[model samples]
Target: MKKSIDYSIEHKKWLNKRRNKKISVTICQFAILIIFIALWEIAGSLGWINTFITSTPSRVLASIYNLYESGVLFYHIGITLLETILGFLIATILGTFIAIILWWSETLRKILDPYIVVLNSLPKIALGPLIIIWIGAGMQSIIAICVLILIIITIISMLNNFLECDKEKILLMRSMGANKFQILFKLILPSAIPGFISVLKINVGMSWVGTIIGEYLVSSAGLGYLIVYGSQVFKLDLVMASTILLCVLASIMYLLVSLLEKIVLKHR
Candidate 1:
């Protein structure tokens, strides 16, 4: 009874230690961000850095306030956010489905392997003009660009994960009279959960990148549009403000993905 009680106490201590460590790391991250902002503000005020070019934190905030007052802040954010989310969902679902199809047919996989590699290697930017022409200069084009950028990546990552499933375990399942479909659901899919989560994480970043790039090419409204306009007009404050907003949005998306991962893993 005494040994069991002692063991429980030790386990609690270990868990507490881990919790404290996580807290400390989070605090440090916030502290570093605060310190960096302070230094940036001080440097700009002292003329140690070019405020006109870099834009101080205060100026950036003021620019954001101006956008809010004009009632356009959320409009631009919503545009970019919507595009990113749509692209992410479409690419993930389509790519995963295609991967499964490829995995199920060895002949199909072999036939498409070279083509897939070629598509993956092609520069997405070179196709941007064609995308604009094909899809037209609209939101559809933006989402299409984002999807094109992410789908190939998703296919490659997921296909590799599915292919890497344990051959021995598959054979054992076969010996037990399990069909391919049963083995896949009972083993392959379960084992690929981690890879799927990883793919989600990658998609979070790629989604943003693709959306921003699309906006750069043909958007009339979005954070990327603001960036392009700001740079053209030399409105450094707007550029800085838009950039900060992008960072915040991207970080929020990534954190949401991480939270999803935690939930899935817990259930797993």
Candidate 2:
């Protein structure tokens, strides 16, 4: 009974510490953002900065409100979000499978390593024109761009994680007569979950970038298209508003990945 009471007290103390830490971080972020906006407003109003080009936070907020009222913001946001999620899911699954295949075949991995590296090193955005031409300039092109951007990164991250698996544990499994498939499923894949989560986190931003670039190149709808349209019309406020919305969406996706990491790591 005494030990149980002590454990309860310890748990409470830990919880309190965590709560305080979170509060501190939140306050710090808000304070910095407030300071930045204040300085930006003052500078723009005082003519120290060009409001027409740079755009102030207040103008951006107003633009957001206007866009919201028109019901156009949600339409673009939804399309971009859909493209990002679809591309992320496709790239992650394919990348994980490729990593598993490479893990199992040293000869194949050796033969493909150089090709993978070359593909990864190439600038993905440069392929935008070709992708649009091949995919016919629409959601398909956007998803294709996002998938291309994410797949190589995911494969590289997962391959490294797989290679770094504990040799002793793998040897023990082998000594027990575990077959290749059993060893991969029971050991390699489980060990790489954390790395997979990390890849997802990275791909969240990349997916957004890919979709936006794709939209910029060729799309009738999406946040990127909005930005392009705003720029063509010389509406800096609209561009700023669209950019902020994109940032918010990417941040939300990143937070989801972070939550997944916590849940998966807890079981580990």
Candidate 3:
């Protein structure tokens, strides 16, 4: 009875510590944001800084409200979000499959390893003209750009994870007559879940980058288009609003990946 009570007290203390830490971190983040915005607003209002270049929070809000009233705000957001989701899912799935294949065949891995490194090192923007020609200037081209940017990175990261997996465990499974498929499913994938989650976190920002760059190159709509158009017209407020929205969407996507990581960790 005493030991049970002691265990309960200890657990409660740990929980309290975790809760306090989380609250402090959240408060600090919001505090920093609020302080920065307050200073920016003051600077703009006092004529201490050029609002024409930097824009102020009020102007940014007004711009967002204007976009909202124009009925194209959601439309643009939806297009970019759709492209981001599609590209992220396709790249993750395709990358994982390719990584598994490489893990399975040493000869194939050796043959393709150098090529993969080279592709990863090459500037993706250099392929923009070719992409425009091949995919032909639309959402298709945008998504293709995103996939091209993400796939090589994913494959390289995942292959490294698979290679770093516990070799002794793999040997044990092999000794127990486990086939390649079984070993992959039971051991390799489970071990690589954390790495996959890490890559997902990174790819959230990457997807947005790809989509925006594509939109800059060619798009009738999207936050990226808004940003480009805003800059051309010297509408700094509109550019800032589009940028803030992009940051929010990217944060949400990253949070979803974090939630998935927590769930996976719990399950394991």
Candidate 4:
């Protein structure tokens, strides 16, 4: 009973230490952001950098406020956010399904291996015009572009992960009269959970890239459109505000994914 109590106390102490470390890291992150912004505002005020081009933090805040007053801020944000979320979901689900199919078919995998490599190496931007032409310049085209950019990478990453499952354990399962599907369900997929999460993390970034690129090509209303318009009109403040908002949105999405990872790992 004494040993049990001692172990429990030690475990609680370790948890507290880890919690404190996380708090310190978070504080440092916010401190760096605050310092950077302070320096940036100071430099712009003192004329160390071209405020017209670089745009001061104050100017960005004012521009965002103007956008809010104009009532178009959320409209633009909603369009881009919707497109990004849709593209992200479609790409992740389709890519994962395709990866599973590829893993199940060795003959198909061998045949498509070269093609997959070529596609991965190809600059997806080059296909942007074609995608627009084929899909007709709208949300569909944007989502298609996002999926095209992400699906190949997802397939390759997930397929490799599935292949990397412990061969001896697989053999053991097979020796025990487990079928391919059984082995896959019982061993392979579960083992590849970490890899799937990693793929999801990567796809988060890729999804944003693809969506932005698509919007760059043909967008009437979005943060991308705002950026393009601001640059054309030399509204650097607007550009900076949009860019900052984009960063904030992406960071929020990433944090949500990290939270999901924590929950999954804890359960596992």
Candidate 5:
């Protein structure tokens, strides 16, 4: 009938609009990158910006090529990626457990909420040295830093999300003779899916920050180490190249998490 035809038209419009928006966003991102790079290269070539300190794109590429030729490129990349992934996964798991614990106990939640806020606000870099001293350097120290940065934040964030779930629904479940564990598993966790995915997105960035900071403190290898060494030796090109590579790697990681989010959204 007419109503069905109208509904079909509206659906088509929605689909087309969504498709256009996505295409525009992607195009904008690429355009911005290309424009910025072109500007940077022009400025460097024109000596409007000091290429020695700013480091031109050509120099960065040459440095990367050198690293690739030396066979140290993948080694450092792999180390940093491994550390970042390990920290991200472990922090997510630990944070989930802590969030659940906080949600389960009113007394504990009251006691710990302020502490979690304080810990999250504290600059993690200030503790990097202490972490290195305690963990005695290496990948363990890097991971510990990541966990420190991510876990409390995750717990605080997700616990708030858990608290925001529909109270009426919880009450109905309670009336139906649902125990705490049953309610948690069936309703609370399911409701918090978006929050958890958000946490994953956040953790992706935090993982890199934590790993790089940790490497700055104690790593003999990895991108952070390369950056530190490059600066010490006045090799600005290498520093810039390492930083650009970090950006690329982090973007790839974020894209993977975004893909996961899409899958989760579609399934839901």
Candidate 6:
């Protein structure tokens, strides 16, 4: 009975600590946001800054409400989100496969390493025109650009992780008559989970960048298209609203990836 009471107290303490941490984070995020918005509103209202060029947060919020009322915000957001998801998924799968192949073949890895580096080093924006030409001006091009941006990063990250696997454990597996595939499944891939999550987190932002660039190059729809249109029309409020929405979406993606990492780490 005494042991049970101690365990309950310890559990309560853990819960209290977790709750406090969560509240602290929430307060910090909102505090920063509030400070920024207050400053912007003050500057604009006081005529210390050009509201026409740099709209206040209030203006942006109004634009968001206006866009929502017009029912077009969701349409643009959906297109961008779909493109991001598709491109991210394709890049992750392709990158993992390439990493696996390179891990299995030292000769192939050496031969391809330079090419991978070159591809990774190439500015993705430079490929915007080519991708639009190849995929045509639509969601396909956007997805393609996003994939191009993320694939190299994912491959490099996963390959590095795969190569960092414990050599002793690999050798032990081989001595135990484990096949190449078995070794990869049991050791290499498992060991690379943290790296994979890291890649996903990185690629989430990259995916947004690629999509926005692609949209800027050519697109009739999407948040990027909205940004371009807003800039052309000199509607700073619209631009700010689109930017804030993008931030919110990226945050959601990050939180999801973090949750995935937590689950993976728990299993580990």
For all predicted structures, in order, the TM-scores are 0.89, 0.88, 0.90, 0.88, 0.87, 0.89
Using TM-score as the measure, name the better of candidate 4 and candidate 5. 4
> After best superposition, candidate 4 residue 199: deviation in angstroms?
0.3
Off by more than 4 A, model 3: 1-26
Candidate topping lDDT: 1
Model 1, 1-268: lDDT tens digits are 3454656777878877989999999999999999999999999999999999999999999999999999999999999999999999999999999999999999999999999999999977679889999979989999999999999999999999999999999999999999989988998889899999999999999999999999999999999999999999999999999999999999999999999899889966
| Residue lDDT tens for model 3, 106-164 | 99999997899899999887797799998799999889888889999999999999999
Q: Put down candidate 4 lDDT per residue, 66-97, tens digits, no spaces.
A: 99999999999998888888888888888888
- Give each prediction's root-mean-square deviation over alpha carbons: 3.2, 3.5, 3.2, 3.6, 3.8, 3.3
What does candidate 1 score on TM?
Answer: 0.89
lDDT of 5 by residue, 142-231 (tens): 989988888888888888989999999999999999999999999999999998999999999989998998888888999999999999
Q: Comparing 3 and 5 by TM-score, which wins?
A: 3
Q: Please, what is the whole-model Cα lDDT of each candidate in the order they appear?
A: 0.95, 0.90, 0.92, 0.90, 0.91, 0.91
Candidate 2 structure quality by residue, lDDT tens digits, 1-268:
3454656777878877989999999999999999999999999989999999889999999999998899887888999999989998999999989988888899999999999999999998888899888869789999999999999988889999999999999999999999988889999889888888888888888889888888888899989998999999989998988998988888989998999899889977
Candidate 6 segments whose C-alpha is farther than 4 A from its true place: 1-29
Instruction: Give the residue spans of candidate 5 off by over 4 A.
Output: 1-29
Clashing pairs in 2: none
Error of 5 at 103 (Å): 1.0
Candidate 3: C-alpha lDDT: 0.92
What lDDT tens digits, residue by residue, belong to model 6 across residues 40-113? 99999999999999999889999999999999989999999999899989999998998899999999999998
For candidate 3, report its TM-score.
0.90
Clashing pairs in model 3, backbone N/Cα/C closer than 3 A? none
